[model samples]
Each structure stands twice: as structure tokens, then as C-alpha cells.
Target: MAMFRIFLGAVFAAIAIYTIITGTSHGWNLVPVFFGDMAAMNWPGQFNFDFFTFLLLSGLWLAWRHHFTPAGLLLGIIGVFGGMLFLSAYLLVASIRAKGDIAEIMLGRARASAIGKQ
Candidate 1:
């Protein structure tokens, strides 16, 4: 689980970095590709790069701690799960076209609902 957390943290950090870099350079054109076209058309300015920076840093911190307080755990789970879902939905067609292992890939989703128990 720790390894999984670390891997997820790294992925999110890389993504946040990419979003910041490319968005600053190209006015967030990368967002539509990274997220979705609908999101690109209606992105919330409140949930911009700074928000992602906080999210990415929080994920990294929680992963390094090995465990979290209930709220932190919830955040970690949402970060992992939401990230996976968003990525999966966006890539489903591509994966199907490439004949990839969909089930294996989907196991990446760390359900946020599990955090409700905490």
C-alpha cells in the first residue's frame, strides 16, 4: 500500500507540474487533453494550478507518512480515486483500441468511498 501510495503521489506530482508548466506556457490548452474537453470549456478558476499544487503536495506528504489522520486519509483516497477515475474515463477508448488489460489498469482506482469509514 505504501508503494502504491508513493507511485500515486509521484504520478500526481508529475501531473501537477506538467499542468503548471504547460498551462503557464500555453494558456492551459493541455488541460483539455489532460482532463476533458468539457472541463476545458468550463474549468473553475478557483480550482486552478495552485489548487493542484496543494493537492499534489498533500498526496506526497500523506504517502510519505505511511498513514494519515482520518481527514488526511480521506483526502488521500479521494486524490487517488478521483485521479484514477478521471484518467480511466479519458483513456478508455485508447486502451480499448490498444487492446490493453483493462481490469489490471482499473485496479489503479483507490475508491474514495472507503474513506467514508474512517
Candidate 2:
């Protein structure tokens, strides 16, 4: 758990720093470039599509973890758009909140508690 927390922390920091640098240089207009790459159908486009799928999966999982409540749905959208910047921070907080319980981290509090009761 300690190691997991450290890993999440490192991911959050690294991605955050990288994002800042990239955004500063690129002017933060990522949508066109991202979608344009996909339209181009090249290696960068292929990679972007793959990464987009992963982000979509991440968003769906987050929504499912929260049982798709309004807040969960909102978080799902944010997860897709915010990408690792949102996810790393979210996982770090969830890990602490779950007290290192992997099941709780994945399943959320209510679901994890219900599973335990069974």
C-alpha cells in the first residue's frame, strides 16, 4: 500500500509536470491536434486512438465503481477528459480512503462494504 501510494504520487507529479510543460508550449488546444492525429490514420493516430480507448475504459470503470450515480457520471466525464491528471490524484485519494484495501479501492465504499457483509 505504501508503495502503491508512492507510485500514484509519482505518476500524479510526473504527469502534472509534463502537462504543464506541454500545455505551455502547445497553447492547451489539444482537441484539434488529438482528433486530427486520429483522422490522419498514422502511427500517432493509432496511438491516440488506443489511448482514447483506455481513457474511455477508465471513465466507464469510475462510473461503475460509484454505481453510476449523478456524481459518478460526472466523474466519468471528467475521467475521460482529465485523463491521468484526474485519475492519478483520484486513485491516490481513494487508496488512502480505503486504507489500502484493494477491493475497496476498486469497488468503492458502499459496494465493498456490501461485499464484506456477504
Error of 1 at 14 (Å): 0.4
Clashes of each: 0, 0
Give one digit per residue, the lDDT tens place, for model 2 in 1-108. Answer: 998889889998999999999999989999999999999999999999999999999999999998999999999999999999899999999998899899999999
| lDDT, model 2, position 30 | 97
Candidate 1 lDDT over 1-118, as tens digits, reads: 3444455556656777776787798794555544553355446543554456665764654443334667656646565535643333334533454345443233222432234346
Q: Clashing residue pairs in candidate 1, if any?
A: none
Candidate 1 C-alpha error for residue 85, in Å: 9.7
Give the number of the best model, judged by TM-score.
Answer: 2
lDDT of candidate 2 at residue 52, scale 0 to 100? 100
> Cα RMSD for candidate 2?
0.8
* lDDT, model 2: 0.95
